[model samples]
Target chain A: MRKQWLKWLLPVLAFLVAFGLGRLDSRLYRQPIGQVIAVKTVKSVKTVDNFDNQDRTTTQEATVRFLNTSRRGQTTTITNQFTYSGTVDSPLRRGTQVFLTKSSGPWRLSNFKRDAIVLALAAFTLALLMLIVRKRLWFISASIAVNAILFTLATHIQTDASRPLVWVLFSGLAIVFAVVTALFVVGWRPVCAVVVGGTVGATALAVGLGYAIFALTGYRDLHLEAVKYVTQSPQLLFFIQIVIGSLGAVLDECSDIAISIMQLDGSGKKRFNAGMAIGRNVMGPLITVLFMIFIAETFAEAVLWLRNGNAIDQTISWVMGLGFAQSLISGFGIVIAIPLTSLLATLAGKKEVAA
Target chain B: MTTLSALALTLLVLMLAVGGKQGLSDAFALLLNAGLMILAVILIAGGFAPLAVAAVIGLIVLAVTIFLSTTDMNVAGPAFVASLLVMTGVIAVVVVGVLFSHTGGFGAEDTEDLEGFSLTVGVSFQQVLIATGLLSTLGAIAEAATAVAAGLIELGDDATAAGRQDIAQAIIGTALNTLFFGFFGGFSALFIWFAKLRYPFWEVLNDQIFAGELIQVLFSVIAVAATVPMTMWVVGRRHREEG
Candidate 1:
C-alpha cells in the first residue's frame, strides 16, 4: 500500500507541475504572447500558380490582447495572410494563444504556444514510464536527462555547422553516448566493456563503410541539396548524423544480445548459436524501426513534391535520397552488430571451446 | 537515386552475408515494407484521404513486418494482436498531437525549398502529419510487441517474478535505444540545422520542424511504454491458458 503511493504520488505531482507550467509559462517569454479576440476576413482571392495548382489567398485582420511584455493586456491589430496550403502560415482561430514577432512597426504572428501540448504529453509519458519502470525509473530518467543536456550543449558549442572540428567533436560525443548508455544498461562490469566495444566497433564500421562508399562514388547523386538550407557541406552534416545515428539501435542490440548470451549455459558454439537466434529475433524489428524513422522525416516533404506533380523517381532523387542513404548505412550497423556481439559473448565465455 | 539503390543493394548483400537466409527474408520484408510506405505516400498524393490510407496501409505493414519476418507463430501471433490494440491507442495519441500541436505543415526552414509550390495539394497537411506520425511509429510499436512476446515465449513455463524483469528490460531498452535514438538519427540534420541558424532553445521549441519532431518522438516512446503492459497481458493469457 505504501509503495502504491510511492509510485502514484510522484507522477501525480509531476503532472501538476508540468501542466501548470504549460498553462502559466507565458509570462516568461521575451516575445509577445497574445490571445486572438476577433478575426475579420478583409480579402479573399483565388489564384493559380505556375504549376496550375489552385489555392485561395485570404487576408485577415486579427485583434490581439497581449498577455505578456510591457504591453500586457493591450490590443493591436495585426494582418495575417494565409493560403489553404499553409506552407508557411496557417489561419488562427479566436481564443488561441500565439507568439508575436515584432517587425519594424507591425506585430506579426510568429508561432503558436505549443509548449502546453509538449509538456502535457511529456507528463503523460513520464507518469506512464514511472508506473511501468517502478524502481529503475530513476536510471532511465537520469540517462535521458544527461544525454539531452550533452547533446544540446555540443550542438551549441559547434556553432560552425560545417567546421572540421565536428568530426572530432561528435566522434567523441558518440563514444561518450555509447559508453554512458552502456553503463546505464549494464552498469559497471566487465561485460560493460564488451557491450560498449561491440556498439562502437559496429557503429564505426557501418558509418565508415558509408563514408567510403560515398567518397568512392564521388558523392554522385547523393542529393546533397535536400538539405539545401545548409550553405556548406551537407555531406559533412550527414557524416556526423550517421555516426551518431546508428549508435542507438546498435547499442541496444549489442547490450541485449550480450546480456542474454552471458546468462546462458553452453559451449562456444552452442552459445554462439543461441546468440545468433536472439540477434535474429530483434534484427527484423530494428531494421524496420530505423529505416522507417529515416523515411518519416522526409515523407511529408516527398509527399508534397509528389502531389505538386513531381515524378516518383525525381522525388526520390531530391527528397528522399539523403534519408534513404542514412537508413541503409545505419541499417548495416544493426545487421552486423548481431554476430559481433555474439562473437564477443562466445569469446568472453569461452570456458568450454567445443568447436 | 543511383547512390541509394547501390547502397541498398550493398545492404542486401551484407544482410545475406551476415544473417544468411533469415537476413535475406528480413531484407525482402523490409523492401516490401518500404514499397508499401512509398505506395501509401503515392495514394495520399493521388488525392486520397491521408488518414484512411495511413490506417489501411499501416495495418498491412505491421502484418507483413510481423508475420513475414519470423516463422514462429508463438511470437508472431500474440505480437500481432497486441500491436493492433496498441496501434489503436497510438493512432489516438498521434491525432491529439497533430490537432493540438498543429505540427502539420512545413516550417520556415522549408520556405526556401517550397517556394513556388502550392500548399494546396488538395489534402490537409494536418492529415498528412497524422499519417506520418501513424506510419513512422508503427515499426517501433510492432517491434516492441515482438520483443516482449519473444522474451515471454522463451520464458515458457517458468514465467514468474523473474520474468517481469526481462519484460521490463526489453520494453525500456526498446524505447531508449531503438525508438529514442532512432529519433536522433531521424532528426540529426534538423538538430544541426537549428544550431546552425542559432535558434535558442525557447525559440527552437516553438519552431514547426522541431515541434513536429518532438511530438513524434514522444508518441513513439509513449507507444513503447504502453506496449510492455499490453503485450505482457496478451501473451500472459496465452501462457496461462496453455499451462
Candidate 2:
C-alpha cells in the first residue's frame, strides 16, 4: 500500500520541483531574459493585398524585467512591432520568458526562452511513463537514453565532417535500430537474422528504385532546393531524408511480418501466404501514416505559400515536394518489405513438411 | 510522367498487387484524406478561424480513417470513443505546448524561401501550429487505440488477467518502436542540419524548430501510452453495460 502511494506521489512531486526549476533556470543563461510584465498595442495599421489576404500590423510597448546578466533586476519598456499572420513576428504576451538581443537602442525579442514548458512537458511524459509502464519501464528508458547518446555522437561527427553525414550515419543508425529491435524487442533468434537482412535489403532496393526513377526523370519539377535551413547540398540532404525516413517503416513492417510468419505451423508456401495476409492488413495504414505526417509537417508552410499567391500545384512542389518524394520512397520500401520479409522468414525458420 | 504522379501510380499498383482490393481501398482512403487536408488548408488560407477549421476537419478525418479502416463495430466503436477521449487530452497538451514554445512562425531558415510572400494573411500562426499538431498525431493515436481495442476483442470471452498482460505488452512494445524509431529516422536530417550550422547545445534546446518537434514527439509517447489503459477501461465499461 505504501509502495502504491509512493508511485503516485513521486511523479507529482518530481513534476512540481521540475516546473519550479525550469522557471528559475533563467539565471543559468548567457543570453538576456525578459519577463513580460505589461504589454499594450500602441498602434494598429491594416494592409490589404490583391490576393485577398488582409491583415493588421501592430506596434506595441512592453514593460519587462531583466532576469539575467549584470542588469539582473532592471525594468524597462521596449517597443515591438508584429503582424497578425505572425509569419515573422507575433504579439508578445504577459509572463512569456523571451530571449532578448541588444543591437543599438532597446533590446529586441529574438526567440522565446521556453525551457519551462519543455521541462514541464518532459516531466509530465516521464511521470506517465513511470505510472503506466511501471515494471518494464527500464526497457523504454534505456532505449531512449541509448538513442540520445547515439544521436549526440552523430551530431558530433557531422560538425567536423566537410559534408552533412546524415545519409552515412543514419544508414549505420538504421542497422543499429533494426538489430536492437530484433534482438531486444523481437527476442533474437536465428530467424531475426532474416528480419534484419530483409529490412536492410528492402530499404536499399526501395531507395535505389526511387533514386533511379528520380534520376531518369531528371529531377524535374521536384524542388530539392526548397528544403529549409541548410547550406549543405540539397540533393544529398534529400537522399538522407529518404534513407532515414524509410528505415523505421521498413523495420516495423519487416519485423511484424517475420515474427508472425515464424510462429505459423505450415510449409514455406503457406507461411509466406499467411505472412502476406498479415502484411496486407497493415499495408494501407502504414503507408498513409507516414504520408499524413509529411503533410502535417509541411501544412503551415504550404498554407503560407498559398496565401502568398503561389498556385496550388506550385505551392505543393515548393513546400511538400521533398516530403512527397520521401513518402513515395518510403511507400515503395514498405511494400517491398512485405514480400521480402515473408520470403526470408519462410526460408530461414523451421523445417517444412510437404503439404 | 511527373515525379509525384508517376511515383504515386507505382505505389498504387504495388499496393494493389500485394494488398488487392483492400489495398486499393486503403490507397483510395488515403487520397480522400489528402483531399481533406488540402480543403482544410484552403479554408484557413481563405481567412477562416484556423482553430475552428482544424477542429472540424480533425473530427471528420478521425471518423474517415477509423470507420474506413474496419467494418467491425466491435473494433471501430470502442476505438473511436477512446481516440476522442485521448484527443481531448492531447489537444490540451498541444495548446499549452504551442503557446509556450512560440514555434508558430516559420523559423529564420525559411525566410529566404518566403522572401516575396506576404506576411499579412490575417490568420494566427499559433493556431496553425496547434492544428498541425492535432493532425500529425491523429494517425498514430488512432492507430494505437484501434490496435488495443482490436486485440482485446480478438481475445473474445477469454480476456483473462494473463491475456490482458500479453496484449498490453505487444501494444506497448510496438508503440515504443514505432514512435521512437520513426522520430529518430524522420529527424536525422534535421540533426545533421543542426550540426552543420554548429549551433550551441543551449541554442539548439531553445530553438523553435528543434524544441517544438522534440516536445511533440514526447507528447506522442504519452498519448499512445495513455491509450492502452483508456482503451481497456472503455472496453470493460461497455462490456459491463452490455451484460
Candidate 3:
C-alpha cells in the first residue's frame, strides 16, 4: 500500500521539480535585450490577398501588454500583418497570447505562446512516462535531462571554439556520453562491456566508413543546403551527426547480441555459431528499421518536391541523398557492433571462467 | 552510379554475403517498403489527407518489414500487434503535442529555400508536420516492438524456466539503454546546428523544426516503454498456452 503511494507520489514530485527547473531556466535566459511583451489581439482591420488569392495576409490591430523589462504591464496597440496560412506566420485570433518585439521602430509579432506550450507538453509527457513505467521513470527522465544539459554545454563550448577544437570537443563529448550512459543504464557488469564496446567500436567504424564514402564519391553528393546557417564547416557537422546518431541503435544491437551470447555462454553451448545466428537474425530487421527512419525524416521534403512535379532523380539527390548516407553509415555501425559486442561478451565470459 | 546507389549496392552485397537468403529477402522487403512510402508521399502531395496516408503507409511498412524479415508466424504475429499498438500510441501523443505546440510550418532558416515557392501552396503545413512526425516515429516503434517480441520469444525458446518477469526486465533494460543513448547520439548534430547559429535557448526550444524532431524522439521513447509490456504479455500468454 505504501509502495503504491510512493509510485504515484514520486512522479508527481518529479513533474513539479522538472516544471520548476524549466521555469527557472527560462527566466535566467529570457534576456532583456529587446522589449518582450505578452500581447492579445484586439481586432482584425483588413486583409490583402496575394498570389492569385491563394495566400491571404491579414492586418490586425492588437493590444499588447509587456511581460518583461521596464515596460512591464504596459498595454499598447500595435498593427501586425501575418499570413492566413498558419505555416509561414501564425494566424492570430482575438485573445491569443503572443510575444511582441519592440525595437527602434514599431512593435512586431514575434511568436505565439510557444515556450509556455512546450513546457506544458513536456510536463505532460513526464507525467505520462511516470504513469507508464512507474519506478523506472526516474532513471529514464533523469538520464534524458542530464544528457540534454550535457549536450547544451557541449554545444556552447563547440560554438565558442575553433574548427579543430570543435571536432575534438564533440568527439570527446560523444565518448563521455557513451561511457556515462552505460554506467547509468546497465551498471558494472558484462552488459557494460557490450555497451561500451559497441558504442566506441560503432562510432569509430562509422567515422571511418563515412570518411571513406566521402572520399570515394569525391565529396560530390554531400548536401550543404540543410546547414547553410551553420557558421562551422558543414562537413564536420555531418560527421558529428553520423557519429552521434549511430550510438543508440548500435548500443541497442550490442545489448541484444551481448545478452543473447551471455545466455548461450551460461548454457555452455556453442557460443560462436549461436552468436552468428543471432547476428544474422538481427541485422536485416535492424537495417530496414534504420533506413525507414532516415526515409521518414525526408518524406515531407520529398513530397513537397514531388508536389512541385520535380523529377525523381532530382528529388532523390536533394531529399534522400544525405539522409540515406547518414542512415547507411549508422546501419553499418549497428551491423558491425553485433559481432564486436558478441566477441566482447564471449571474451568476458572466458575471463570469468579463468577466474 | 551515384554514391547512394553505390552504397545501396554495396550493402546488398554485404548483406547477401553475411545474412544469405534472409538478407536477400530483407533487402527485397526494404525496397518494397521504400516504394510504399514513396507512394504514400505521392498520395499526400496529390491532396490526400496526410494522416490517413501516413497510417496506411505505416501499417504496410510494419507488415512488410516485420513479417517478411522474420520466418515464424508466432514471432511475427505478436510483433505485428505490438508494433501497431505502440505506433498508434506514438501517433496519438505526437498529434496532440504538435497541435498544442503549433510547432508546424517553415522555420526562419527555411526562407532561403522557399524563395520561389509560394507559401500559399494550399497544402496544410500543420498536417504535413503530423504526417512527418508519425512517419519518423514509425521506424523506431516498429524496431523496438520487433526487438522486444523477438528477444522475448527467443528467450522463451531457450530458457523455458525463465518467468515472464525476467524476460520483461531484460527487454526493459535493453530498451532504455538503446533509446537514451540513441537520443544523445542521434540529435547531437541538430543541437550543434542550433548552437552554431546561436539560436537562443528559448528560440531553440520553440523552433517548429526542432520541436517537431524532439517530439518525435519523445514519442518514440514512450512507444518503446509501452512495447516492452505489450510484447511480454503476448509472448508470455503464448508460452503459457503452449505449455
Candidate 4:
C-alpha cells in the first residue's frame, strides 16, 4: 500500500514542482522593477533561407507578444523588422519587450527572449525531484546539493569570499561539517563518529587530491593560465572540488557494500575481514565503471581527430592532452575514494554492529 | 601502432572477451549510433529537414541494429519502443523550453568559433543540434536495453529460470541507479567546469554550440527519466507474455 501510494504520488509531485516554480516566477515579476502595462502581438513576414536560394521567402509569421513595464511608457516594441535585412516574422506588438525597449518608447528592441527563466527553473526542479525521491537516491542528491549550495553560499562570506586562500580554508571546514551531517542523518552514526571521522577523511582526501593534480599538471607556468577558468587557485580549488565531487559516490559505495555485508553477518560481531572482502569485490567493478565513463566521453574527440587525419602526436596535443590529464586525476580520486570511504564506513558500521 | 590505436585495440579485445558474441552486436550498435550523428550533420548541411530525416533514420538504424544483434526479439521490440518514446518525450520538453525561453536563432559566436571546422566537414548548426539531441540520449537507451537483456538472460543463467515479471522488477531498480551513476561520472567534470568558470550565463546560452551542449545534457537526463518507466512497462508485458 505504501508503494502504491508513492507510485500514484508522481502526478501530485509534478504539480507541486510546477506550481512552486510558477508562483516564484510570478512573484519575481511582480517586484517593483517591472510590471507589464501593455501587450501587443506582432505580425510580420520574413525569409528563412536566403543564402542557398532566393526563390522562397518561407513566409514565416508569429505573434510577437510585447510587454511595457515602466511608468514613463516610452519604451517601444522590439521588432525584427528594424534590425534584419529580411522580412519580419510579424508586426511588432507595442508591449513586446522581448526584443524591444522596455522604456516608454522609440528605442530599438535589443533582446526579447523572456521564457528562458521559467524553463530553467522547471528543468532544475524536475532534475532535483527525479534523483531525490528514491530511498538510496536521496543520499546522493543530498550530499551533492548540500555541498554545492553551501559552497556557493560561502562565496558570500566576507572573510571566505574575499580571498582564494580563505575560501579554500573555510570551505575545507564546510566540507567536514557537511559530511558529518550527511553521515549522521543518513547513516545514523553517533554524532562524534560522524563529525570526527568525517573531518579526518575529508581533510586527508582534499589534501591528497590537491597534490595529485599539481603533480600531474607538471606545475608548469601553465597552471596560472588554467587557474583563471578552472579554479581561483588551481592547486587549492582542484582539491576542494574533487573532495566534494567524490564524497557522494564514495560514501554511497561504502555504505552499500558494508550494509549488505552486515546483513549477511547478522547478530554477530561485525566481521572486518568479510567487510574488506565485499569492498574488494565491489571495488573492481566500481573502478571499471568510473574509468570507462571518463574515457568514453572523450571518444568523440578521438573520432574527430581520426577523421581529420591528424597525426598521433598532433592529435594528442590538440584533442586529448588536457581532457585526458583531468580524467586520470579524477579517476584516481574515484579509485582512492572507494577505499578511503569504505574503510571509514566499515569501522563505523562495525562499531554499530558490535554495540 | 600509436598509443590511442593500441588503446582502441585493447578495448575491442576486452569487449569481445567479456561480452563474446554480444560484443560484435554491441559494436554494430555503437557504429550505427555514431553514424547517425554524422549523417545528421550531412543531411542538415544538404538542406534536408534535419529533425524529420534524422528521426526516421535514427529509428530505423537503431531498430535494425538492435534487433539483428539480439536473439531475444521480445526484449528488442520493447526496448526499441521505449527508446523512441523517450526520445520523443525529451524533444517535446526541449521544444517547449525553447519556446518559453524565447531563445531562438543561431549565434554568430558558434559560427565564429566552429563554423570553419564545420564547413570543412559539411556540417551545419541545424545538423549539429539534431545530432546532439539524438546521440546524447543514446547512452540511456543502451543502458536500458542492457538492463532488460541482462535481467531476462539471468532468468535462464543455468538450467533453471526465475519468474519473468519478478526478475524484470528487480532488474529495473538495478538499471535505474546504474544509468544515473553512469551519467553522473561522465557529466560531472563538464558540470564542474562550467560552474567553476563562472562564464556569464546569458553568454553561454547565446552561443549556439554551448547551447547545443546544454540542450544535449538536459535531453539526456529526460531520456533517462522517460526510459525507466517505459522500460519497466515493456519488460512487464514481455514477462507476462512469456509466462
Candidate 5:
C-alpha cells in the first residue's frame, strides 16, 4: 500500500519540480532581449488567400502592452501582416501574448505564447515517465541532462575550427559520451566494458565502411546539397554526422546483445550458440528501427518533391540517397556490434569464471 | 558502382553473414518498409490527410518489422498489440503538442532549399510536420516494444518465477539506454551545427527544425517508457492464462 502511494507521490513531486524549473527558464528569456510585450488582437482588416488557396494572408491591428524594458506599461498600436501559410504566422486571436520586436520603427509580432506551452508539455511528459518507471526515472533523466550538457559543451569546443581539429574534438567527445553513458546506465560491470567496446568498435567499422563507400562511388552520389549552414568542410561534416549518428544505435544494440549474452552465460548453458541465436532474434528489429529513422527524416523532403511534380526517380536520387546511405551505415554499425559484443561478453564471462 | 548501390550490396552481404536466412528475411522486410513509406508520401502529396497516412504507415511498419520478423505467432501477437497501443497514445500526445507549439512549416534558414518550390504547393506544412514527427517516433516505439516482447518471450514461462516487477525493471533499464543514446547519437551533428553557427540558446530552443527534433526525441522516449509496462502486462497476462 505504501509502495503504491510512493509511486503516485513521486511523479507528482517530479512534475512540480520540473514545472518550476521550466517556469524559471522561461522567465529568464524575458530579460531585455527585445521589446517584450503582451499583445491583444484588436481586429482583422482583411484576410487574403494566397495563390495556393490553401493558406491565408491576414492583415491585422493589434494593441500591444509592453511588459519590460523602458517601455514597461506602455501601450502601442501596430499593424502586422501574416504572410506565411502555416503556424509560422502567429494565429490572430483576441488576447494572445506575443513578442514585439522593434527594429527601426515598425514593431513585429512573433510566437504566440510558445514558451509556456512547451514547458507544460515537457512537464507532462516528465511526470508520465516518472510515474511509469518509478525510481529508474532518475537515472534516465540524469543521463539525458548530462548528455545534453556534454553535447552542448562539445559543440561549443568545435566551433570555428579546421576540419582536422573538428574531427579530433568530436571523436574525443564521442568517447567521453560513450563511457559516461555506459557507466551511468550499467555501472562498472563487464557489461559496461562490452558496451563501450561495442560502441567504439562499431563506430570505427562504420566510419571505415562509409569512407570505402564514398571512395568506391567517387563521391558522386553524396548529397552535398543537404548540408546546411556548414561552418566546416561539408564533406568532413557529412562524414562526422554518419559516425556520430551511428554511436547511439550501436551502443543500444551492443547493450542488448551483451546483456543477452551475459544472461545466457549466467544460465550455464550452451552460451555461445545461445548468444548467436539471441543476436539473430534481435538484429531484425534493430535494423528495422535504423531504417525507419532514416525514412522518417527524409519523408518530408520526398513529399515536397513529389508535390512539386518532380519525377519519382529524381526524388529518389536527390532525397532518398542520403537517407539510404545513413541508414545502411548505421545499420552496419549495429550489425557488426552484435558479434563484437557477443565476443566481449563471452570473454568477460570466461574471465569471471577463471577469477 | 554508385555509393548507394555499393552500400546496399555491402549491407546485404553483412546481413547474410550475420544471421543468414533470418537476416535475409529481415532485409526484405526493410525494403518493404521503405517502399511503404514512399507510397505513403506519394499519397500525402496526392491530397490524403497526413495524420491518417502517417498512422496507417506506422501500423504497417510495426507489423512488418516486428511481427513478420518473428515466426512465433504468440510472441508477435503481444508485441504487435502492445506497440500499436503505445504508438497510438504517443502520436496523440505528439500531435497535440505540435499543434500548440506552432512548430510546423519552413523557417528563414530554409530559404535556400525552398528557392525552387512554390509556397502555394497546395499542401499544408503543418500536416507535413505532424507526419514527419510521427514517422520519426514510430521506429523507437516499435524497437522498444519488440525488444521487451522478444526478451520476455525468450525468458519463457520460467520468467514468471522472477516476478513481474523484476521483469519490468530489467526491460525499463535497457529500453531507457536504447532510446536515450539513440537520440543523442542521431542528433549530435545538428547540435554541432547550431553551436558552430553561434545560435543563441533561446534561438536554438525556438528554432523550428531544432524544436521538431527535440519533440521527436522526447516523444520517442515517452513511447518507449510506456511500452515497458505495457509489454510486461500483456506478456504477464498471457503467461497467467497459459498457466
Candidate 6:
C-alpha cells in the first residue's frame, strides 16, 4: 500500500520537477511563453535542385505569423524554410497553432521546451492515475521513468532515423538491462521472466524481419542514418531503442494483467488456470488495441498513397519498405506478450508454493 | 471494391472473434465516435470555436457512453469524470499549442501531405488544417476515455469478486499502460518515419504543416497524460462518495 502511495507521490514530484525544468528551459531559451491565437502561412517557395530531379527537390519556404494569445495576443511572424518530403507540393495554410522559439532578431520556432511540457504532463498524469486506480503505481512509474529516458535518448541521437548496426546492439542490451531493473523494482520475478521471454522472442522476430527486408528490397546498401549527436552504431541502437521503446508497455501489461488475474482468482484457486485465463482475456483485447494503434497510423499514409492513384506495386512497395516495418516488428512483441506473461505468472506463482 | 472487401472481412472476423454482442457494441462505438468526429470537423471548419465545441461534445459523448455502457452506474460515473478532466487538459494543450508559440500556419505540424491533398481536392486550406488538428486528436481522447472507463469497471468487478482493492489498483495501472502504449506506439511509428525520411531538421521543425501536426501530437499526449491522473482522482472521489 505504501509502495503504491510512493508511486503516485513520485510522479507528482516528477511532474512538479518537470514543470519547473520546463519553465527554466523556457526562461533560458528566452522563448515566448505566451498563448498562440492565430497562425498564418503567408508565402511558400519551393526550390528545386535540378530540372531533371525537379520532382524530388522541391523545398518550401513558408512565412508564418503567430499571435501570442498566452500573453494577450503578442504577435510575431516566422518564415519556416522546409522541403516537401511528402509527395505533395504545398503544406498547411494560415491559422494553425505551432510552438515557436526566437530564431533571429524577432522570429521563433518549436523546440524541446514548448513540446516536452505537454508530453511530460500527459505521461505523468496517466502514470499517476493508473497507479491510483490499479495499485500498480510503481510499475507505471518505472515505465514512465524508462520512457522518459528513452525520449531523452531519442532526442540525444544526433543522426537521422536510421542508426548504425553497432549502436543498435549496445542500446538494445542497455534497454534490456534498464527495463529489467525497472521490473525488478516493481515485481521482480515476473518482470524478469517477461524481459527474458520478450527479448528472446523479439530477437527471433528481428532476424526474420531483417532477412525479409533483405529479400524484398534487395537494396542492402541504402544509406541508413546513424544517431546524429552520439558517435556510435546508431542502427544497432535503433533496434535496441525499438526494443526498449516497445518493452515497457508490454512488460507493464504482462505484469499488470498477470497480477490482476492472480488476485482475481482469489487466494484459494490453483492459480495456474487463473493465470492462463487472465492472459487469454488481456492478450486478445490488447492485441486488438495494439493492432488499431499501429494499423491506423500506417493506414493514413497508405490511403494517401493509394489516393494518388499510384500503382498497386508502388503502394505495396511503400508500405513494405517503410511504414509497416516498425509496426510489424511491434506486432511480434504484442503476440509474444501473451505466452511470455502467462508463463512468467505460472513460474512466479510457484515461488509462493504453500500459499 | 478491394478496400471495401477487406474492411468487410475484417469487421466480420472481429465480430466473430469478440462475440456478436460485444463486437456489435464496440462497432457501434467506433461508428458513433467517427461520425461525431467528422461532424466536429465540419463544425470546427464552420468557425464554431473548434476547441470549445470539441470539449463539450467530447465530454458529453464520454459521459453518455460510459453511463450507457456500464452495468454498475458508480463505476461509469467516476470514469466519466476522469475522462472529462483529462479531456480538459488535452484541449488546453492543443489550444495553447497553436496560440502559445510564434510559429505560423494552420493546424498542428506534420500535415504537409494533407495540405497538398486538400489543395488538390479543392478544400479551403484553413478548413483542412483545422479539421486535421481537431480530428487527429480525437482518436487519442476517445481511446483514453474508453480505457479509463473500461479500467474502472474492470477494477470494480475485480474488487467485488476478489475483495482485494490492491489488485484492482494493479489492474488499473496495467490498463493505463495499455492505453499509453496503445496510443504512443501509433505516434512513435510516424515520428520515426519522419526521421528516416530525412525531413530536413530545421525545415521540418519550421514548416507550418509540421507545426500543426506537432501541436496535435503534443495536445493528444497531454490529454492522455491528464486523463490518466484525472480519471484516478475522479474515480477515487466518486468511489468514496458511493461508499
Top candidate when judged by DockQ against the true structure: 2
What root-mean-square deviation over C-alphas does model 4 reach? 8.9
Candidate 2 chain B, poorest ten consecutive residues by summed lDDT = B180-189
- DockQ preference between candidates 1 and 5, better one: 1
Supply DockQ values for each candidate.
0.61, 0.62, 0.45, 0.13, 0.52, 0.12
TM for every model, in the order presented, reads 0.93, 0.92, 0.84, 0.56, 0.88, 0.54
Q: What pairs collide in candidate 3? A: A244-B185, A245-B186, A248-B182
User: Chain A TM-score for each candidate, in the given order?
Assistant: 0.89, 0.88, 0.78, 0.56, 0.82, 0.52
Q: Give the poorly placed runs of model 6, Cα more than 4 Å off.
A: A1-191, A195-246, A261-270, A280-332, A351-355, B1-89, B102-221, B225-243
**Count of backbone clashes, every candidate in sequence:** 1, 0, 3, 27, 0, 51
Cα lDDT for residue A107, candidate 1:
88
Which residue pairs in candidate 5 have backbone atoms (N, alpha carbon, C) closer than 3 angstroms, thus clashing? none
**Over the stretch A1-355, how does candidate 4's per-residue lDDT look in tens digits?**
6884475456345645663454234223321222224444344333333232211222222233323234333322322442121111222333322433335664444444343444453455355345333443455445545644564444434223446565456556545644543463345544334333533463356345545434554543222222212334444443444444344334444454445444554433355445444443333233332333333333334333333444554544344443333333433433343345445555665577678
Worst 10 residues of 5 chain B by lDDT: B161-170
Interface C-alpha RMSD, model 3: 3.4
Candidate 2, B4-103: lDDT as tens digits: 7777888888888888887787778777787888888888877788878887887877787777776679998998899889888888878878887788
TM-score, candidate 4, is: 0.56
* Model 6 DockQ class: incorrect
Residue range with the least summed lDDT across 10 consecutive positions in model 1 chain A: A7-16
lDDT of each: 0.81, 0.78, 0.67, 0.43, 0.70, 0.45
Off-target runs (Cα >4 Å) in candidate 1 are A1-20, A40-45, A160-162, A228-232, A351-355, B238-243
Overall local distance difference test of candidate 1: 0.81
Native A-B interface contacts kept, per candidate:
0.56, 0.55, 0.46, 0.04, 0.53, 0.07
**With candidate 6 superimposed using the best TM-score fit, by how many Å does residue B69's alpha carbon deviate from the native?**
9.8
lDDT of 2 at A313: 81
Across B1-243, the per-residue lDDT of candidate 4 in tens digits comes to: 332233334434433543456555544554454355445434443546546765676576557545645556666677777777776766665555443333333333323322223122222223334444554455445444544554554454341223544443333333333334344433433344455455455544433334434444455545555565566566666767887
The weakest ten consecutive residues by lDDT in model 3 chain B span B160-169
Query: Worst ten-residue run, lDDT, model 6 chain B?
Result: B118-127
